[model samples]
Target: MARLCLPDGAVRGIDIQGAQTGTVTSYTAGRDGTVTVDNPQHERALRQYGAFPANLGGRSTRGGYRCGVCGFAAYIKTCSRCGGTCEKES
Candidate 1:
């Protein structure tokens, strides 16, 4: 199984094999912004649609910055919420 972290309102189409036929399935991100897929096609499709691999360790594996004032995390050096400076996370 593969775990992906989807942004809010992200959706993807997947192909699934049924008993005698195959069908295209659509999946949407849940409230926690995560989805678990067992199919490789689904994983690839989700990644193509802007979903990234989830890091279970509670830290981003992509290496980004975090806002010092509002605790927001992103790749930008400035915080979008609190208008504070963001520091690079080690």
Candidate 2:
């Protein structure tokens, strides 16, 4: 007899946004309507984990933006890649 096992989590999507993707910048994740490329070891990490949303626009502020390891909650300056501002803008 053969047995089957399924992963509790699955990669959702992969999107290549921004002007120039030469060096990736600004990575974040949230519960709803949030986008992120989870895989760290792989270079082509455009996949996501959360369920895709219907009204991505209306979910403003309801969700949050955080670094791979909960960015805003902690004090993290200068993005790892381009050394940019990770703090939220007013």
Candidate 3:
């Protein structure tokens, strides 16, 4: 199982498959993990090299987002540490 750490610190397991025509990336969540990116550059890279590294989520860097309610800094898309939703500055 591959783990993807979202900006909100939410970790998701994903199943990645590669095909000759393109690559199929599947993430695991109730239903939210089913988005497909058809970037040819990413596709070519996947075909030539491989999937993301095992340590993709090893680091914990948080920036570019903050909790709207409490103004707390967030690493994940959602504010896991603060139990609030995080939003980017507009």
Candidate 4:
């Protein structure tokens, strides 16, 4: 004998804005619209997770800029730690 199982009224509709993708292992939305995911199974799903561009304007303090090559934050034009040039103006 075989049995069939189906969701009756317990299942509710979900409104996801990123992408209609693979099964969700975890989901979270911040008050500031920040989101992150871990261990995304599908490539498309992972891309969708990071589809939104982060608003990075006015986030850094009045000091320096991050190094584009090595991702170092400093006040000087060149990063002392990684020796990378600062691309972003602070």
Residue 20 of candidate 3: its Cα lDDT? 62
Q: What lDDT, from 0 to 1, does candidate 4 have?
A: 0.44
Q: Quantify all predictions' global Cα lDDT against the true fold.
A: 0.67, 0.34, 0.45, 0.44
Q: Where is model 2 more than 4 Å wrong at Cα?
A: 1-75
Per-prediction TM-score, please? 0.47, 0.19, 0.27, 0.31
Clashes of each: 0, 1, 6, 0
Model 4 lDDT tens row, 19-85: 4544444333344444443333332343443433232333542455777886666667888778888
Across 1-90, the per-residue lDDT of candidate 3 in tens digits comes to: 232222222245344565565565654333532223355544344333333322322232333566777665565668756688878643
- Clash pairs detected, candidate 3: 7-75, 7-76, 7-77, 8-76, 8-77, 9-76
Measure candidate 2: CA RMSD: 14.4
Q: Which stretches of model 4 miss by more than 4 angstroms?
A: 1-23, 26-28, 40-46, 49-85
Better of 1 and 3 by TM-score: 1
Best by TM-score: 1
